[model samples]
Target: MPTDAHPAAPRPAVDHDVLIVGGGHNGLTAAAYLARTGKRVLLLERDDHLGGAAVSAEAFEGVDARLSRYSYLVSLLPQRIVDDLGLDVRLVRRRFSSYTPDPRDPSRGLLVDGEADAASARDAFARVGAEGDAEAWQAFYAETARVAERLFPTLTEPLPTRAEARSLIADEHAWDAFVERPLGETIDARFADDLVRGVVATDGLIGTFTDLDDPSLDANRCFLYHVIGGGTGDWDVPVGGMGAVSGELARVAREAGAVLRTDAEVVAIDGDSGEVRWREGGVDRTARAHVVLAGVAPVVLDRLVAAAAGTASGATEPSAGAAASVAPRDEPAAGAHSDEVPLDAGARHRLARAGMPEGAQVKVNLLLTRLPRLADASVAPEQAFAGTFHINELETQLDAAYRRAAAGDLPDPLPCEIYCHTLSDRTILGTGLAESEAQTLTVFGLHVPDRLVDAHGNDELRERLRDAVLASLDSVLAEPIADVIAMDAAGRPCIEVKTTRDLEHALNMPGGNIFHGTLSWPWLEPGAEAATPADRWGVATAHPRVLMCGSGAVRGGAVSGIGGHNAAMAVLEEELP
Candidate 1:
């Protein structure tokens, strides 16, 4: 197999065919693919551990639970990446799709069982006075399934034009509902029940903070990504937690002869000369490469390149809750950053438009003594919490919450969802914990924008938001959720709440925007350019030698490796010596 000579030898200066910044899952993926082609690949990560957000950690002190700390669940990960790398990753499909308790009556709710018969689901819908929605729900997802079948395959291929993608989807009605019009209008037209409509709309608002009726239709983009995963949109639990996914990728990359280094922070990159400078353990170093794959947000890339050209300002660290506004799509005027290092005009425009990304959700992890009882008597607690358990997310409630949050006030009865990881996979629990029937709960709160964190300090807002979220969950439960929380060894409550500000400090994610930045349309606009191979693959930067291999890439989002895969494909298209 092709390998970097003397893999363990330390070199002050070395030249590699490909140098990747950030050892997140995407970086690892790019390294494995490039190294398998006999190219010398070097990956550097700022954190001591490899995985970025996709990792499992023993969060509670003296608690034996290994929770998927940041990013939970697996949906968009392609089977192709697994087969290509021969990764030993197992994902467990939850039998239930989601259970949303009715806000008007906690005892009545809708439970969607994936393994149940059509009549069973219809009965559940009937209980919530949404019997008419059962047929509409199936039809809506059926259309998405068709779109998924067509659109998912193009993710790994070269960029498809707007016209090309529309043609591929074939169904004009489906395209109009998801691609052309605002999602709110379509949901309003199709579904009659508020709770049922909210169930569908929740997918649109996951990490994005946007009004459903916004003409820009950014929510449509987010919704499309949620429903098109793995051509089925079935979010499965990763066996042994999210860390297993990254661990397998790291292993495959290492075994394929890629050099991986942790705690190495890349400070600058000279795009013209392909020189990268990084600091590790208080020691500064440099390396040259034929190509550089930036596995970071676009805004961060601009800062690095600016620093290399000596045109950057004194402020190197990104501020918390950076610009929460949606980036304008129009090409911005010049005179922002300098024009050195072949920074493309459009790339600069994108940077200027990209204010700090604003992540919208608040994540709270809890290790519970046992599953809390649901108010809905017909459905057992195990069945309701197994999948996504949504609370206070009715269509009207979601809109009202957005209004309140946009007005700089915290939404009362915060809309959120809960996922019981232990229900599907018991291995995440320690031997003692598992034997005692302990469970782990991952709560994701919607409409909790970074702006709130900016208005209220992280410490203050964390507690307030945590209280609000638990209260919302409590609204649907038989007893208070706080009573069931397991205590850590030190007598502290085993609850971990991460606000966007917290994410920014912990993960170097500017604005804590989970997708790196607002997600872009998978296909280029009608008149957009795609002249180069990198451009065609949607991984291009201003510099020809540099490409994006992170969530910031056109088709990149969630746990999917499309960005890295396409970046490798783009590099492989060129003849490399």
Candidate 2:
């Protein structure tokens, strides 16, 4: 708590070119890239292991299932980074994109396949919607697919000027539909069916806490990242588990001579001097570097800076001509905060403007004795459960859930989605359980905002929400799902629910936001010019020596290491070839 980046006590010291805070995927990525470039790097993690929220674990005690607990799928990670690091990882394409059973008639459902079975897909869409709307669905996604192709490659490259990106696509309507207007307006104009429109709209609200009709266009930004993050907009499954991603990155970083320490909790940071103070082995320690890559939430960074402010020397005064260098010229002067200044004051201003990020998704992991029977008799459980299963997620229901949550209550059934990881990868289940009988079900509930937990508390609300979700699932199943649940050694059902509060406490994700901040468009305003090359990189902070390598940076959501890769690229002044 002393918050000394350069500990006054003069204990053992370590020196590195880059000191990375938080050993999540982003930090590991930064460390791996910088160390591979022959820069000395030191990475520290407070958790026992790395990967941050992109980790897999056995949520249920006495269960053999290793489920992707918090963050489930992979869509944002770039293949360029994968090949660059020579990561030994396997990503399996999902056979289907989603399957939604109609609550009115349980036997009816809509299924979207990955193999482009156009006739079958159109027929499925027609079951719950007009044939014309189904046709509109096809046209709409075709447009998004084009945007995906043109946009995803730019993520690894320098941040494109918004105009440059729009020019690359060469479609004014495409730009207006995705970038300029609210996504709900676009969804409304294209899709007529409530269920179909909701299916398309859900892409925009995964981790974002906002209304579909909100003018902020925050939902559009989230939708853009989801559809275009992987260059193809396809969300694949990491064969072993989500951990395979960060674990492989950790191996690469360590092999590259980057020093990594676990249980090393960073207490304070001096962004001006590029110094970090942390507690390791029950002792305070310090490290110095030319750069400090903060792979943490903005809230966490603020606390660290506030703690280190008192110890910082008279470097607080704004340096001569530093204003132009510290802030983007297109933005206001106040937007720039000198790295040499006492960051507490500036941090407060930015923190207030950034606002607190609150995640609205509930992660529920369940070990099933067998895949549940589907009410849609025509569709097999294997194919239906192979991808995302939507329950009470019609546009009307989804919108209603948002309103209900805003009014301090959970929806009647709670709009949610489910996927069985074992349907694609049996490696996660042990030998005895891998014989197709045992499986893992991961559920994500939407519109269950953080305030719900604050109002009900974790204990009372978790059970109520869990029961509602189970009942909702049963509404679409042939039989009660609870009957086929695998039991733990304690005879308890192998079901574990993690609320927003649970994530906040467990992962240190302020408000349980998986992205660490509100998702933003990858590019700056169309005509805005960057003040410096680092500004074009999008990873550089107002603090010159410190850069963001987390989800808070541009192009920095999901399991993507774009932020980490960009931060390293900025420090090394390296650009993609």
| Top candidate, metric lDDT | 1
Model 1 local distance difference test score: 0.86
Which residue pairs in candidate 1 collide?
Answer: none
Least well predicted 10-residue stretch by lDDT in candidate 1: 319-328
Model 2 lDDT tens row, 1-577: 4566654564324477789999989999999999998898899999889989878887777777788888878888889999999999898899798998987688989888878677876787778755678778778888888899998999998888777888987889989999889999999998888888888899998878789889999899999988885767888889989988889999999999999999999988887777889998899998877788888876566556645675222123331111111111122234345666555644543433333467888888899999889889889998888888888888888888888889999888788889888989988887888975888898988888887876787899899888988998999999999998999988999989998879877887767888877776788765654775567778766577777888777788789888899888988883321
Error of 2 at 341 (Å): 32
Candidate with the greatest TM-score versus the true structure: 1
Q: Cα miss at 241, model 1 (Å)?
A: 0.6
- Candidate 1 residues 477-511, lDDT tens each? 99999899999999998999999988877877767
lDDT of 2: 0.81
TM-score of each: 0.91, 0.89
lDDT of each: 0.86, 0.81
State the RMSD for candidate 2. Answer: 7.7
